[model samples]
Target: MGLRSALFAAQYDAAMRHAEHEELSSRRAALLSGLRGIVYDVGAGTGANLPYLPPSCRVTAVEPDPNMRKRLLARVGPANAVRVVDASAEALPANDASVDAVVFTLVLCSVPDQAAALAEAKRVLKPDGKLLFLEHVRDAGAHAAFQDMLRPVWSFAAQGCQLNRNTVAAISAAGFTVDERENFTVGPAWLPVNPMVRGRATPGG
Candidate 1:
């Protein structure tokens, strides 16, 4: 892995472990509950969402960062059927319309091209498949301005994570019709990246 990837992997779990709280756990379980067949989890950092997946689902985790993959492998429980692939969101290693569902959690911001990644997610999904996502997004007013101001520095330190990405809008632009959505703020009010969106989207209108 490259320097940025190494750095991100080193600090990722420590920085994000708090996200495994009860509320987020409930949300994750709910998101993965309906999914079945083959599922590709993009940016599966440390395999945080693995436990929440339904037992009926088979998972393929795509993670480009090697260090993160190491931890992810460690987290894969004995019973859960999981395969790991070295891949990025912009380019997934799966056949067209082959996957039953695509899962993304706190991953859209760090991708170099959110739209391209979303397009790839669409490409790998079955016609009736869903894309489930949980992401931090740009808020309005002063919070948004704060995100803009700190994004340059933050991205450099946080492995290309943009603090101000309007991910929901980007998802829509990538040809996925958002069938369900929930927007809310997490963490402290003072944090610019507190605003988050979680939901499921389907390919085409």
Candidate 2:
């Protein structure tokens, strides 16, 4: 693995400490509560959602980055029903209609193909399975323009995390019916990744 990747993984939690402690952690807890059965935590970076998930349910934490996977492994304990797997978002390891739920927390922005990843989520999910998602979307008006301007540089530095992705629209375009959603911002107002959305979706008929 390259030094940059290793460095990013090593310092991820530390870099996110302020945001998590101040805003995102409580949202994550509320969003992940009561989830049951076989759930997939897509792009499970350092297992951030591990603590919030229901222990009664099995969790398949999918992370493609080896460096991130190493840290994620350290977070899993005997008490937590979590399994760390080496896999990307576009290509999952589960069988079709096998997973009870799929989770995406601040991950869609970095996936090579957001549509394909969401498609895979739909493919692996049972007919009634739900998709729980929390993502920072494109901002409004002038902020969106600024995000576009910052996209190239920010994405390069942040390991391909796009500065402005319309994740909620992408989720709907993937044929999932958004059942519930709430829009809010996190971190400082100057941060580019503001105007986030957390929601639940079901496979559309």
Q: Highest TM-score: give the candidate number.
A: 2
Error of 1 at 24 (Å): 2.2
In the range 1-205, model 1's lDDT, one tens digit per residue, is 2877777787877776676573477778888886789999999988878988877888899998788898898888665589988999999999999999999998999988898999999999999999999988998899899999999999888878899999999999999999999877667766766788789999998
The C-alpha TM-scores of every prediction are 0.93, 0.96
- Clashing pairs for model 2 are none
Candidate 1 positional error at 197, Å? 0.8
In every candidate, how many clashes are there?
A: 0, 0
**Residue 35, model 1: Cα distance from true site in angstroms:** 1.3
